[model samples]
Target: MRAVRDFASGIVHEVNNILGVIIGNAHLAKKSSANAEALEKYMGEVRDAAEEGRELMRHVAVLAGEQSSRARPLSLNDLVINVTSELDPPPELDLSSEEATVQLDVWMAREALAGVVQFMAETKAVTSLRVATRVVGSAAALTIEDDGASPTDDELRALFAPFTKLDGRPKVGLQLTSLADLASRSRGYVTAGPREPHGLRIVLTLPVSDGTPSGDRPGVPLSKKGV
Candidate 1:
């Protein structure tokens, strides 16, 4: 009962935050009507917020068992590079390196990872980021480490549960929750905590792929994460 309440509270917190971004951006867009450049910028933020809201809804639906998991064999390293390469990271983040191929839902892996990276950028003055892979038992673990910002013990405890957020707000951390669920569905897991004396580390583990890569060329549609 307590756990359910906490999860509900976390979801409320995140939805409120995402809506706040949309509202704030909409106000800015309204106020910037006089400047074409500013209007465009504000409108872009508004669009981002709206897209985020839609994505959040989708994630929540999946978390609630409203969607099916489409998974396949994939190179974890390849998938990580594919997703991260498309996004612009924080200016200070030095992510240049790591790897293992695994079998999992590529969309889940991409969303789970990209969401955490973006959330970290929003909530922390990140100085550096490190990503790599390691073999853990029968699983291939995708590891992400940051050299700035830290989460408390309580935040760490709820990192993987549905409705939990790393920044402790209502800004939609469903990505991380989905990651945990995704890993579980693949017969693996996800874990996070403090790293050394600074920063944090998050690992999403999935079953290693025993097969070879598909023949699809690069820059294929989003379906390439896994067929």
Candidate 2:
């Protein structure tokens, strides 16, 4: 298992490096284009394709169990707020607030946020995504509900199966699984289920570090961390 994980991790790293070069060259090409007509369109596609590939590689790494787990103090409230704002959900979604604070790793928070965002974007059924975060004694919780088409039981079961794309394409389901793994590593867990009436709800619960301050430290970068 460890050998397989290491091999997968190496592949992901190499793929990411290649993607970085592709994106860089594409950006340079875009800038150099004086006409900005035909070349611009092609460059845009290249950029999108490269980004998608990178995301796929990330998911693969998680599925292969190639990533190490790290835990630190984090601000649950702030993380959810930032993620929701970035998603820019439609007005139809209602988001609640919980006046609590807790600690977790920043990387895990970002992965959870990205997973929700990618799921929504791919399904296209979600009109809105809302998040509510709360902190209790020695633990933190985040509840993300999306007003989207509900997945069947089989689909939900397949969610964490590596290389299983919900959209019937080659997609890596690493985001959710990686988040779950990270939570478990931190003495926590994650759950996903149907929301009231309709839609999907994902809840993340993790051990909270006591009175930890959020700051810019030399921890793992979100992109390089894992899928």
Candidate 3:
């Protein structure tokens, strides 16, 4: 077990280093070129692929016992807001929401959310997506929905499996799997399936800690807040 863990860590570190170089060069290329439209598009694809590689490494690292032990009070609302802001999805990507609150480890939630965001951003099939959060009873729910193509049965099954990428090599990576694992470790679970007429929806359910605030906790302010 120890050897396996060490090997996984090594792999993750090596991949991260490679990805860093790719992203750096891509940025430099984008900045130096006069007619950068084509170059930027190509570099965007490359950067996305490298990000997938890094995400896979992170997932393996988690399985290799690279998670922290400390648990701090986390605000899910804040985490979601931050991720959406950083991604800066187009205005069409509706970010509707309801009041949701929870207390969890800030680092864990951030990492898990980051993984999810990265997965969506890297997936080519997914064109427009929206993320919403709600608080019900003693739990918090986060729903990420996309109007992209629906996943086949095989793709759905492989969604949560480690290193399982989708067709066209666009969906292959460790982001979703890692995020699922992170949720599980935090006493939460994630589910993904077809939504409405077309597209897919992923819901993450997490238990709310006792004594946590009911209204907007500290940190970032989301789009909508409710009790």
Query: How many backbone overlaps does candidate 1 show?
Result: 3
- Looking at model 2, residue 196 earns an lDDT score of 74
Give the per-residue lDDT digits (tens) of candidate 1, residues 166-193. 5523344566776777777778878898
Q: What is the C-alpha lDDT of each candidate?
A: 0.67, 0.61, 0.65
Q: Pick the candidate with the highest TM-score.
A: 1
- Compared with the true structure, what per-residue lDDT tens digits does model 2 show for residues 1-227? 85457446655665776677677767777777886676677577677768767766665555556344455565665555455444444322233354344455566567756675566555656666666666666666777776676667886776554334454322444566666666666677878887877777778887666665465322323323544
Residue 180, candidate 1: C-alpha displacement in angstroms: 0.7
TM-score of structure candidate 2:
0.63
Which sections of candidate 1 miss by over 4 Å? 13-52, 66-69, 89-99, 162-172, 215-221, 224-227
Q: What is the lDDT of residue 12 in candidate 1?
A: 83
Candidate 3 lDDT by residue in tens digits, 1-227:
75456446656665776677787767767775776676777577677768757655555666556444755555566567666666755313333264455655555566667677666666666667777777777778888887666777898876776555465435444567667877777788999887777677788998876645433343454333111
lDDT of 1: 0.67
Worst 10 residues of 2 by lDDT: 215-224
Model 2 misplaced stretches (Cα beyond 4 Å): 1-47, 58-70, 90-103, 167-172, 215-227
Clashing pairs in 1: 13-170, 14-170, 14-171
TM accuracy, model 3 = 0.64
Error of 2 at 30 (Å): 19
